[model samples]
Target: MRHVVKEKSLEDEEEESLNRQRLTSARREALSLYRDILRATRFFMWPDSRGVLWRDVLRENARREFEEARFEKDPEAVTRLLIGGRDAVESALEKLAEKQRHQIQKERGDGR
Candidate 1:
């Protein structure tokens, strides 16, 4: 009985340790994604004075979304959030690039 109890305790400790490691990794990835999204906001362009407003909106949106997910305890949920955020950021970047390309083409008198 004693040996079985000891083995169970060790197993529990190992499981707890693994969960802590996973949580730590998830937090690190979340923070990295948050920073990347904020940094990418700088590339957003808007005509006239609305540029500043749009940038602020983007920043606030990103912060709010991350805050909403701050209490997520499940590793799978955290991973999903990180992946979704990354995809959204990538899509925004692609749109920005496309817009810039169109502007350049327009300036060159090339209609497409």
Candidate 2:
């Protein structure tokens, strides 16, 4: 019985260590995504209908979303959220680039 208890304690310790490592990794990824989103916002110089800078709106929204997930422990949900956020950022930038390109073409008399 004593030996079994010792073995169980060791297993528990290992599991705890793994959970800590996972949490640390998730935190790192989240911070990286947050910073990347902020950096990407530099391109959005336009103002919204509310007269607020898009950059400010984006930063605030990102901060709020991160805060909402601050205590989430499910690894799957975290991964999904990260991926979705990244995709949204990339898509927005691509759309912006397309509009800029179209505008440039129109100015050059090459757009329809």
lDDT for model 1 comes to 0.86
**Candidate 2 lDDT (Cα, 0 to 1):** 0.92
Q: lDDT score, residue 86, model 1? A: 92
lDDT of each: 0.86, 0.92
Estimate TM-scores for all models.
Answer: 0.85, 0.88
Considering every candidate listed, which one attains the maximal lDDT? Answer: 2
Off by over 4 Å in 1: 1-8, 45-52
Q: Model 1 residue 94 lDDT?
A: 92
Deviation in Å, model 1, residue 8 alpha carbon:
6.4
How many angstroms is residue 48 displaced in model 2 relative to the true structure, after the best TM-score fit? 1.1
Q: Residues 27-72, candidate 1: write the lDDT tens digits.
A: 9988999889888988764533654666678888898998999999
Q: Evaluated with TM-score, which candidate comes out highest?
A: 2
